[model samples]
Target: MASRSDAEAAANAATGRPRVAVFRPDDERLESAVSLLSDLGVEPVPDPMLAVEPTGETPRENADYVVLTSKTGAELAAEAGWEPGASTVCAIGPATSASMEAVGYAVDLVPDEYTSSGLVETLESEADLDGASVEVARSDHGSPVLLDGLSAAGADVHETVLYRLVRPPESGDAVDLAASGDLDAACFTSSLTVEHFFEAATERGTTDAVAVGLDRAVVGAIGEPTRETLTAFGIDADVVASEATFDALARETVAAVDR
Candidate 1:
């Protein structure tokens, strides 16, 4: 009995294209990822692992610094008409900066590295955190490194949950494909996505099988945090994108698959 993954693998092999699993949210981000993979000449398995749930919350108006970690957060803040007011606006990466700019917001600072720790380092060097009010606006699953580091630097930090990242109900197909050894590579953009991938695999009773398959596949993580999460699951990332962006992740993963 040929499994669905077996059939899909045969079709992919016939087409001479590598199958890459992408676990972005089901929005323009996912659509853009799929298009990017197609342009990179790979067959993309568009399994949307994360779904955004807006909390209808905004950042504090009185903070001295406002930090946004993701493009979605920037868009949500703009949608809520949340202005920076007196606060200096900081973005974690170029994409978030671009998103803020798209909404006519001025991005005052962006880290050289695009991680939470990177942002913290940038802020510590660039801003006077002693007794400063900093508001971090992002998703509920945001890393504590930013808040903890800022507080340690003597900044009074507050977090506003702009949205919640929940695993979508229909996100396990890629897990099944990976378990069946149909995937050639996977691009994990966040730590949460890596965690949710295994959650799906565990639910399907294929966690070990999926892990084995992934061990044989070229895996790409968007940043150190995501790579650490994969390591916790006993999976070594074959490629960690030099840039912590999906575009870089997808390009690097596809290039690895080609090699």
Candidate 2:
């Protein structure tokens, strides 16, 4: 008469093996997850779901500040000959700060909370942004939250699109793996991965899409935004990892499933 929770806990405890679903798109994280999961007696399934594309648009006009939300976005900027020399720079997290620093840009600030909301909160409290022209280096989607917040705070904010989130050519393979139930589950590190991969599946067929999406592979959302995307797709995630990072996803995967 064990409840579902008790059954899952017992299953995990008795087996002492974690069947983990790694969703990072075959990058270094995939290797790391595979290594860590193997060391921990967990099976790591590396299935990449999204691709990041950069739009090599030069800055239309210079600004006093530039903010980068993703390490990839900052790297894209560096690739596009965009380097912050005198202007102050803001990054969303430690990974992003390292990326910017690698390109020789000194990160003026990184929010403690590591979200757009937290970034805005930090600007409101710590920055003297009055009359400062700010530029945001970003991908194709999301609101103008950073710009809007800076503008509302009396800063002149400008936006520069640096990248786009697209489906990788091999995303279909990942989808097929999920449909076949070999994936067990997939982790959504970002909303873009959810949008592009699901759109790719729907393009193939809705029934197959649902088969791939159903509880077949427990969905692991990394944060609130990713969770929102999964819910929008009519899939209630089995777990939303503690933080918006891959390490959190990997750890949560190990905790939730049994081998």
Candidate 3:
């Protein structure tokens, strides 16, 4: 079977499809980006620069509540047979909430902004976390925003590293397209994707070439964190989604490239 990029290229050859580099891990998660990009008439090229490895750890047994910042965290936590233990589950966004719900876990709250700060603000205003035991399920290299915020809010925060991100064996075709200037745009969903993309480019000795390609193409980020990560790599995102969702990112990427 042809690869996703090859299949999309052949299908959209006559219409001149916009090529998009999707830097997500290889899993069902990748299909979400593929479906959204295809719907927008963009050719999404898989650039699985990062792979997720589960840590096989269960959640804390005696927590009053649980917090998850990403869909992956929610999925892994459910898979690990984590008992919520009367904890009111809180997620960062609709996607994360939906993931938890699919695995028979109920999400009690989701922030308005779909971010750490947003979750913190909501908890501060709507919930009484004072003296509550909150368990945070996240990746090994996860951000400290949620942890610090919960601690400050008087919640006894316990952390469980449910998974880890590792660089993929190959960078796929993204670097090639970026170097040749064929990639029309790129969507970065996480800070890790930006870091791994640059790492992959550097490994292939195409950092400078990839930088030029990124400059030529319209770059779209899912949120502020991803945009800041891109900026750290000297590639400013041309468009950032108002909402931190793949659906929003797809629409913003198309709009950015159209302009």
TM-score per prediction, in order, is: 0.94, 0.80, 0.92
Candidate 2 accuracy as lDDT = 0.69
Please provide, for model 2 over 1-259, each residue's C-alpha lDDT reduced to its tens digit, 9 standing for 90 to 100: 1112445544654664434555554566567766876775665545565566667874444677778887678777777777676777788878788888887778999988777777888987987879878888787875566667778889887777777776665555446546555455566777777776677677777545555545766678888888888888777888888766677776676566653
Worst lDDT 10-window in candidate 3:
1-10
Clashing residue pairs in all predictions, respectively, total 0, 2, 0
Full candidate order by lDDT, most accurate first: 1, 3, 2
What is candidate 3's lDDT per residue for 96-176, written digit by digit as tens? 898888888888999999888889899889888899888888888777888899899998999988889987776647777
- Number of backbone clashes in candidate 3: 0
Q: For residues 1-259, what per-residue lDDT tens digits would candidate 1 score against the true structure?
A: 1123767756776996888999888888888999999999998888898999999999889899999988899889989998898889999999999999999899999999988899999999988999999999999999988999999999999999999999988788779878998889999999999999999999999999999999989999998989999999999999999999999999999999999
Best by lDDT: 1
lDDT on C-alpha atoms for all candidate structures: 0.91, 0.69, 0.84
Leading candidate by TM-score: 1
Report the error of model 3 at residue 127, Å.
2.0
RMSD vs true structure, all candidates: 2.9, 7.3, 2.1
